[model samples]
Target: MSHVTSPTGLRYHLTHTPPHLTAHSHATLTLTVHNPTPHSIPLPGLTLALPDTPTGTATPHTPGPLTLQPPQGWTTHADSPTHHTLTPPATRDSQPHELPPAGHLTFTLTNYPTSEPGTSTLHLTETPHPGQKGTDNAEPLPLTLTTWPSGTIVNPPTLNKNRYNNGDTATIEWEYSPADGIDYTLTYYPQPAGSGNEKNTVTYAQIQDHSGTAMSNGLRHAVYNTTVPLTTDPVPFILTATYQNDTRTYTTIASVGEPDAQFGKLQVTGHTTLLSTTPQTLTANGSFTSPTEGFLVCWTAPGTAPNKLTVNTNGESRTLSYSICSGSLTLPLAAQSAVSYTADGVSGDQYSVTWIPLGHAINQ
Candidate 1:
């Protein structure tokens, strides 16, 4: 059947028209919901389930677990060991927005059927999608899945990290069936407007294949990447497996970010008076750190080339030394730029530096 229509006049469409997959084979499936009714309708909630220890084919693969990687932008929840409910992201109004009379939405997911080989019937039930802050457990439509027997199935790659900072290291693991020969390639697109885009192919001779476990189809290989640094946000990576002039690509996404350093209190621990050729010091209320190659530079005097005080706050608290023209230095309110630290090694604007004088006004 091309699609299934519910009593509510909502149409459900699954990839492969008839909604079928091969046993022990990995495939990316897409589910689309169409609103064909005269009036607007809510998005149909979807709950996908995988059959455990399926039985149909003669040569069943070793019993293993199933893993599902959902598409981006869907909020997923595991209500049971093998059942997951997929919800759409909330709108700005936090209201249950209705889909236009002729609107539609599509979601994709990658399925890893590594368990016993059999023509197991998969269930993808359609129900009422959850709203702002509630659970939805209503279903009037259901999409059916059928599995066929297969021995040589293409597998998708798995990433070690799901979310990480930009400069973190990650690895990709996948398997390939033994054919005339197999080739592999890795393509990645970093965030921040796709700064780095590159691809590399690994020939069969360069592969260090290992024995397959019960959960894999054929030989397995792992690629360690120390330079999987992301630039801005979550980035998707692709790994292509080519064999017998056919190619299949698998994708995995990883989120990257670095927490911003907060501004802390700095107190002048040394005497209030300072000499032109002498040095001054300040201590932090707590441990200070500069993730980047940045340091704090306090504006000691008001003149051209505002005496750049050298202050290094890497691990422990440090001090600042400057050549101020001996004058009574009164630290103003912290709201002003009395002292600041650089975040990107360029501008000291990320954090505000506050200084609490010891006894009296500081003089240099």
Candidate 2:
């Protein structure tokens, strides 16, 4: 049930038969528009949207034959199966019928139950006239249509990789249609007791919808070392999907493969002379090693990144460039670990660049 009264004393009320809308059967709804203003106003056209069958098309949501049974002395017409428009009657003098003060009109609308469960709204506008064409009211009234699903098609969430390796990109996909609204959530479970990581569920809210193709914010790809703990073998990934005002929810989980990529040895170059052709000298600071040689990618100073064995400093702020090597390259030496990665791939220039210190970047 929904009703809205305008400041001008115009009121609209609606109620449907069968109590609630269901997919298995047809439904009849009663709609009433009342003019309570002392002065008679021109009759208005009632505009309503009907449900579109899951016809597989975005527009013309429905190929319907919606029926409108107006009360005695009233008339109505449908612009389209899903779009309905009701206008005022013609007076004997050919003048448009004016709704007298306190006068009201009622209508009974019927529609076969739609297999695809979804919501729609109803609204009203001024009836069109010869010189005064119909115009939408400044404020359109809304009446929500609630529905019950009999057999709704649901697509479960799927990840690109059942098992993920360090630096591996993961794509999450599912068939999604708007159900009042859209929602997607991804959660990374805490490490198993001991992995040198804080045991807490990490959640990301930045879900993107690429026509329901890829809906993730760099889950396994972005700085995998950190997003996915290095020590935790096979991280558990859970994704939940739902919609606004929808009671049904869908969720799934899969174990992501462990990460083997860790820093060999970090050699932090405290200083470097790049312009000279004779020979560039670099000064190295002692760095740490994590059990030596276990990695998905080996990065080198090929002028591809600043750390061609180069180090970044807030004090200097040089955008160092480095290169991506097929084999592993140790950090040689390290200071403190602070690293971050972008989702770009090794084939590209963004071959696992580090934003944090060499330590954290290597281990993570």
Candidate 3:
């Protein structure tokens, strides 16, 4: 229930316009055959071929000689308007022979130089002269041919490492937008150094603050405030984007605090007498190691200077100072009376201190 024919014939404007053909190699089709009953439409003898599919087919060879035109007094003749097999349509008394009421018809399909551009379906017929009436005759249409191929496209760039700790903050983000001219580079590597490579490469327009929207879920943010140190180190993360011409590299994997706890080591060991006599009892043993294997301890003094250092450590006190210096420690131990220290738990240094002596200051 719809009708509007004005493809302006020429085979419906060359089977639907758009440079139907160009150059020494033709491919044109404009066939608009519509006689909606009012009478006058007869032109038969059609043949367009193709049939041999067992999962292998490539056919195209029909050039030099193919002409069918009608747009004036309407008088055409064609027992062989030339057709040399473009393959596909296989059937119709073996096919060939088409001429109608001369209402409309335009054809100039050629191809010969070994063609592979595909799409086939063209066969029209309408023949009934001689007290004619075989359904009025003229109906069988199909024409399509388009070829354009050659390509390569790869676009992948993203990274956003938001939340961070152990030194306050950090943020690093990224993204990409480059058209064909091809030549890119953006890189990063370092985080508990697990090693994935590409530790450096930058030039996707030189990305630092990367203010050009790159956090499309590939998250990479950097906002470090500073000073979050006491022990434990290992903030070795990575983010990469590469194409320094070609080998392609896009990666993002992070790690902070696990590579032996980043970087730290402070050790100043045991017993700080500094000269003790009456009521003598001063000791100072220390240890603090990092690299993931943590440990801690501390002790300071100078006659009633026990500020807060009493973690005698397990195993009582054999004058102390054995495993108390495990991973890291900062020593400034001055003494004369009571002093003790402990911290040999390990793992980024846990922390411990002890100091006591109230009766050894020249009996003041």
TM-score of each: 0.32, 0.36, 0.18
Residue-wise C-alpha lDDT for candidate 1, range 123-146, written one tens digit per residue? 666555545222254443545444
Model 1, which residues run further than 4 Å from truth? 16-20, 53-73, 114-119, 126-140, 151-364
Task: Give the whole-model CA lDDT for all candidates, comma-separated.
Answer: 0.50, 0.49, 0.34
Candidate 3 per-residue lDDT over residues 1-364, each given as its tens digit: 1113321221333352323222124444444445443334433333432211111235434444544454333444543433322212233675422333344444333332213322334444333334445524434343433321112212343224433333333444434433223344544433224444324444545543455443444433322222222122433333333221123344444334322233378555983332112322223344321211112234333232122333432322334333323232333332221234532323212333423222232221
Find the candidate with the highest lDDT and give its number: 1
Which prediction has more favorable lDDT, 2 or 3? Answer: 2
Could you tell me the lDDT of residue 265 within candidate 2? 88
User: For model 3, how big is the CA root-mean-square deviation?
Assistant: 21.3
Model 3, global lDDT: 0.34
TM-score of 3: 0.18
Error of 1 at 136 (Å): 10
For candidate 3, the 10 contiguous residues with the lowest summed lDDT are 1-10
How high is the lDDT of residue 23 in model 1? Answer: 51
Query: How many collisions between residues are there in candidate 1?
Result: 2
On TM-score, the stronger of 1 and 2 is 2
